[model samples]
Target: MNTKQKVKYKKNSKKKMNWITDHLFLFPTILFFLIFILYPILYNIMLSFKKMDVSNFMTGGVWAGLANYQAIFSDPLLYKALLNSFIFTFACIVIEFIIGFALALLFRQKFPGVNFMRGLILVVWMLPSVVVGVLYKWIMAGDSGVLNFVLTQVGLIEENILWVSSEQFALIAVTAANIWHGIPFYMIILLGGLSTLPRDLYEAAKIDGANGWKSFLKITLPLMKPTVLVLLMLGLINSFKVFDLIYVMTGGGPLDATTVIPYYAYKLSFLQFNFGEGGAVSGIMLILVIILAIVYLKLMQKEEAN
Candidate 1:
């Protein structure tokens, strides 16, 4: 070939090689995710429509039509689990917002040990969630829990209360544990959002005779709306999927009071050996979360339009 022809061929080869190099790194990740996540999700969807139990292991799973869904709806324990899940999610999100906002504001200021405190909080966030669950399980122990000892020492009560032993207290106790473990995450996210906010807004509000609370209510809140909404959506999703803490602490005990949807699904799959029912629960959760995501997206689009 001539020199010009050789140059043209080299250019084409370079572009092809570059494209291959750019996408080669993604191959392993894409393959692994498809195998691990996508395949299981599709299998679960199939399982939800089948009659799979311990006995039919050797044989293929039988088709159950709508029987699994019907069983889920007819179970009273399902309603209890749903109610507790909502209650836990609502309380944790509200408390996390208030506490996390306060913490972010405090961290925004300069103070002694501020850097160290921020680092400490981030460490808590980095800790594995199972470890957090284990720690709280110890803290809420009826006989020797630190919380009970502190309360008794302060004379708040005559005796140690069973924090996770009764239906009335189980949901709240699990929520409190979740709040403790999750607050650091909220603090970090809100702090990042706060830093991006212009200082000039607060300065202008102050100049206009707006007090601190008024400035926060009017200026800070409106400006933080997007961040707050994102956090709330994610927080609710995580709270709804809570299982480690409740499983380790209460094990859906106290008359099945602390059974959130995830733990219930686990119970159905592992404990009861009813894969179809568990898969159905998983399908329902997936649909609910997708609905939430769609709602949030619509609201966000409306806000942008206005």
Candidate 2:
């Protein structure tokens, strides 16, 4: 070969090797995504179209087309689960956001042991959901629970309210537990957003005679829009997937009052041995999450563009 041709060949070989190496670095992540995420999702989609019960689980299921989906839609339980999931998520988001924002504001001020107090609050969020569920289960016990004791002492209730056992209060009990566990997370996110605000804007607002509330309404809300949007989107998705706490605490009981979508799916698959129906419920949740995720991405892109 000519010298220039040989040099070109060497350069091409070098580029090829570099390309292979760079692509090789991504192989593990790609493999993990395919095996753990994509494969299960595809398999579940397939399973949702089958007629699978405990009787035929070992032998595999017959092709049922859209039967599973049809059954799920026809059942009133599905609608009830959806309603409970929405109510639980909505309550958590509202209560957690309001309290989280307030705490974020308070912690923003310079104070004694501020960092320690912040860290202490985070301990609640850091606990595993199962642990939090267990803790609340004990606290909400009707007989000798601390909560009932306190309420009785304070005259808030004439008797134990049966927080987790009664159909009337079971959903509220779980929701309150979830809210407590989630508050620190929202507080941290809002705190970080608050930290990024320009101090000069508040000072500028002061010159215009803007009070604390007025300055917050004018300056803080507008600037924090993106952060708030992202936080709420994430909170919604996470709340929808809440099964561990419900399982550990209520087990979707009190006549299914706390049976949100995730736990409902679990009941169909594990308890009833109706795998096809369970997969259909899961598919519904997957669609909801995918829609939320798409919205989140679109909002992020818009924020970046602006």
Most TM-score-accurate candidate: 2
Clash count for each candidate, listed in order shown: 0, 0
- What is the per-residue lDDT of model 2 for residues 188-209, given as tens digits with 9 covering 90 to 100? 9999999999999999999989
Measured with C-alpha atoms, the lDDT of residue 254 in candidate 2 is 88
The residue pairs in collision within model 1 are none
Give all candidates' CA lDDT scores.
Answer: 0.89, 0.95
TM values, all candidates: 0.93, 0.96
Q: Give the per-residue lDDT digits (tens) of candidate 1, residues 129-244.
A: 77887888788778899989999999998888888787777777788888988899899989999999898989998999999999889988888888988998899898889888
Total residue pair clashes for candidate 2: 0
Query: Which pairs, if any, clash in model 2?
Result: none
Runs in model 2 deviating more than 4 A are 301-306
